[model samples]
Target: MRTGRPRQFDRDEAVRQAMHLFWENGYDATSLSQLKAAIGRGITAPSFYAAFGSKEKLYKETVACYLHSHGRVTDALWDDTLPPRQAIETTLLRSARMQCETGHPKGCMVALGVMSANSEEHRHLLAPLDTARARTREGFIRCVKRGVENGELHAGASPDTLGLVFNSFLFGISTLARDGVPLSIIETSVRQIMALWETFSVKNGNELPNG
Candidate 1:
């Protein structure tokens, strides 16, 4: 006989497992039984129901898990060391890389979910998705403001306009990737987008580190 694995499942771990499941397959495709199996916690349906209330609640928890884990992009982009435009480029490239990388599921959960408008719950899900986008754009605005203060970005550039333009472009890229755009095309497109932003940055004026 051999020693067994850890006895109890951590709630966070379970939620992470659920996040992967939901990320791989949308809410409508993933069943409660399937979630039980995917989590590998030997969880009973009644237990899951009692704890999470319903699949909808479980999905909300999964979104929370996704946000908490991936929100680092916003944090990193807002770092003061990088020029605002370059920071936006870095975040977009990283996000594009994630969409093309193996092991993890491709595409954004929000964009993928928004593709269909079949149900009220599905439509409701777009709210948090939009909120995430808004939060990301806000981060960009803050970064641009910091860049302006330090003269790392163009002084005349409107932060609001730049934020909307960059955010809209990023959302479009995510939508394309979510819709199964080819990896090569995604890479090339993202690189071009980054290059465009790089041209407008104050890096050439000796404002940012290493450009």
Candidate 2:
């Protein structure tokens, strides 16, 4: 008698489930068993390996999915048509709202996922996350540079310093969300954060404080 074909599973759905698992629990904390369970539908170890290649590979795919889905809001940062201030504000607001949403994991996958790498191999596995973060920082730098060029910000303002500050604040919002801070509070804080940009405005005629 001919054997039945192996059961088929939805690869996209599996990646989303795995993304939620990784988003809820950091890379080192999530296990193969947990991953299989999260994928469900009786996905066996061999089947899992055949489908995803390996745990690290699966995590990479999951991160990509998370970026494409929940993380796409920040793409406004790269929109040259928007004013620099608007681009930064849009990124901050979108990120804050996304992080605080109740449906998904509380914090940003990029911010919380793979924070601590136990080994060189693990670091390599998490390299994409690092790249994601670097890209955000670079976007901030570009926006700040554009602000200077457009005279929205003072010529003496430092893009590197401003980028670091903005990226750090963005990352901190993820931590606050994970800590159970309310969405309303995060949104309010976003407004306050945007006010800092005003202090850098060329219209305000403010200069960086001397050391």
Candidate 3:
């Protein structure tokens, strides 16, 4: 008889599945068995341990996947050709559409986890979320600096402080979006923030950060 080769697991797909499950149910509510079932591997606990090493590791992979998908949206918003206010507005509008959907899970996994877990493993699992926040702040700071160099932004505002304010607004809106706020209200709230930027007027969308 001829010997056949064994099948291999798709690590990325496995993590994506894990991410959706965790996004829907959170860390504490999801058990190992649930993870195993959700991942759809015929493998046993020993195999899962061998593949992912630990639940914490699996959680990290899940968060990384979520952030990777989300970062693309950030990339489009952070474009140098767009005004700072438009960038921020675009992100919020997109988020409103995604978060308000009836079929998909609620809010961001990072925001939801920040609210739900306290175990050291859970905290460790969430380190990626901290990194995502820091990256978002850094992107805003970069946009502010670019605006300053181009003379589009006001001279008095500090980039560091601007970044903090921007991040705070985003965080609050993200939480509200998770809570199922209407898109009209979300758009109104975003416009209110844009009014403070001063360099860019949301009315005409003419202010370009680079041009």
Candidate 1, residues 21-96, lDDT tens digits: the string is 7877877778889887766556777667665788888888988777776535556566768766667778777777
Cα displacement (Å) at residue 120, model 1: 3.7
Candidates 1 and 2 compared by lDDT, better number: 2
Query: Each candidate: what lDDT?
Result: 0.69, 0.85, 0.70
List runs of model 3 lying over 4 Å from the truth: 1-12, 41-47, 115-117, 199-211
Task: For each candidate, give its TM-score against the true structure.
Answer: 0.71, 0.91, 0.75
RMSD of each: 6.3, 1.9, 5.3
Clashes per candidate (backbone, < 3 Å): 0, 0, 0
User: What order do candidates take by lDDT, descending?
Assistant: 2, 3, 1
The order by descending TM-score is: 2, 3, 1
lDDT of 3: 0.70
| Candidate with best lDDT | 2
Candidate 2 Cα outliers beyond 4 Å, as residue runs: 1-4, 114-116, 205-208
Report the C-alpha lDDT of model 2 over 79-168, residue by residue, as the tens digit: 999998899889988998999887778889888854745667688877778888899999999999999898888788899998888889
Q: Candidate 2 — which pairs collide?
A: none
